[model samples]
Target: MAPHPPQSRPSTGPDPSAIDTSRRPFVLIWEVTQACDLACDHCRADAHPARHPDELTTSEGKHLLDQAREFGPGQLVVLSGGDPLTRPDLVELIEYGTSRGLRMTLTPSGTSSLTPETVHRLSDAGVTRLAVSLDGATPDTHDTFRGESGSFEQTVRAARAARDAGLPVQINTTVCAQTVDELPALRDLVDELGAVLWSVFFLVPIGRGRVLEPITPDRAETVMQWLSEVSDDAPFGVKTTEAPFYRRVAIQHRRDANETPTDDDIGRRLGITAGDGFAFVSHTGELYPSGFLPESAGTVRDGGLVERYRESELFQSLRDRDALRGKCGACEFRHVCGGSRSRAYAHTGDPLASDPLCAYVPDGYSGPLPEGRVSGD
Candidate 1:
């Protein structure tokens, strides 16, 4: 099927460029399952091949959907998993969530289950968009990284099928030391697949992800610079995940090039950072600041997700940029670029610690180093 004309960029809420901080956290990522066929090297959930007996049932899923509605309308509930498609009741769950006034999206590990018929069913079930991961530009590299031969082919086929089914498609690519060099080719593939958005997720060491080495701070800065330059001409909108500091880098680049930055630019800077504007619910119903952070705030079984989000000290502390440690706490762009809490926690065992992969030294930071500095002493 020929790619459908690109639709206006899809967002869970109002244009992020004009986001209201008072009404933050308009997105909830729900891990619907912990079972997937592939054993990706960077799988954050450490998924198994069999569904956990304690996974949420369809009734519990419906209750969760009802609770999610309390976050307000236009809120995006991203149903993700080891592979959400692994669940037979996925379509039923999607329909249930959407029927309750929540906009839904899906993030499925690309596998045989993502056939054209499955894509059509998902579309019919009210999924606004589908995000599929593509880590490498070539099959050999991607397949090996996924720990499943033929995964690359399946992913490409799924992307095509999703578009053919008239479902908006977003391609998520992980950027690490290994895949950094292949981004240009991956960008080409994204364009070829006619994806509407390309999300670049910088590696955060956690679960199975701890085994893969992340790129150095200097290399990360260089890659962001490259992304900032090429994004202007790319066919799809570009965003970064687990790398909120890219906003500061992008704004600085624009200013260096003599462009006047606007409040919209700054407001748009508030991407899905942990606790501030994002929430994660595990398959077992445990609530977290983010899927990456894995710090439990509460569980859906206790009920009142909105209350738990508001009352959790962890969430509150995360939202308070002044509580951040090291360079991040002292950075002039603290509000706009709070750095990655997950990466900080992974490297220094402190979620409030400065992200080690960010090379930008804050403007007025001359204080003595924090006790467990992940960067240079």
Candidate 2:
């Protein structure tokens, strides 16, 4: 095997030309607040309801909206939080982003205290998609992970409300050892909900999620296999069987049909661009390169939106020649993997660790498996 890519420090200073306006912009999951009503066991953000008052002020949030708009069309603007609906200013943020031609999604704990009027307001605010976390098919498993007794009921109710409002609902499930066995049942529930998509997030063992429960490699593999099966058969517009493993299936699907997804498709399909890709805007108004990790660039408050694009370390690193090469060059799965830096950091405490979840079968480990050949033999 090729030697592992050399470890190098990320460049600290920003370069003005670093912002790749030439390439379509990334999807921005602007985390409006970290104050969430539910304390899910697997949440990497360590969100809680009491923290909202201390997060981004109303002015800071508006600046973030402006920065997101600079990315232009085909970008997604996801308003997330401990629960976005908890923010009184959510409508303004959503409206501001949508006015800039951004497609948007609102991620709530489903305990957003969203009345029917508020739900319709979100749709009017340009939230075309809605994603609610449903870790298990039933309350026993789900509520346990969410750390709330009635979370399942709340999430289900919110999803139904979103659907009834004509917004496409996607169930976001975080697969862990505790919930792995019930994946099939979860998929069945998605179908019953009439939801349009399912995004399965493998437990990354970060923050409170790690403190609660973690998945074994074997369980991760099991979840990946389950997701692939569901993706093949699922009717959702965006169906990723695996968490980070979505790339492989997406590549084949995009190839076999000879369909080329535009920037919007790329962002939403890969969870990268605006409303779709993995993203997180911090309470300080700094953008983590992605939502799954808590790393940051400078605060949007200290600088204009352009300053973030030009100077933020995360953006700079993502665009750096040496950095992207280090990640993109090694591994047989490069073309399909497109490793997410934030996930890498959250899982291994290093932005560059080989993803632990990537299946690594020994060359001669084949036993009773199909064709009597090992995965890497």
For model 2, residues 176-199, the per-residue Cα lDDT tens digits are: 678877778988899888898887
Q: In candidate 1, which residue pairs clash?
A: none
Residue 185, model 2, lDDT = 90
lDDT of each: 0.82, 0.61
State the lDDT at 149 in candidate 2. Answer: 85
* Candidate 1, backbone clash total: 0
State the TM-score for model 1: 0.91
The stretch of ten residues in a row with the least summed lDDT in candidate 1 is 2-11
Q: lDDT of model 1 at residue 254?
A: 68
Candidate 2 lDDT for residue 68: 63
Local error of candidate 1 at residue 65 (angstroms): 0.8
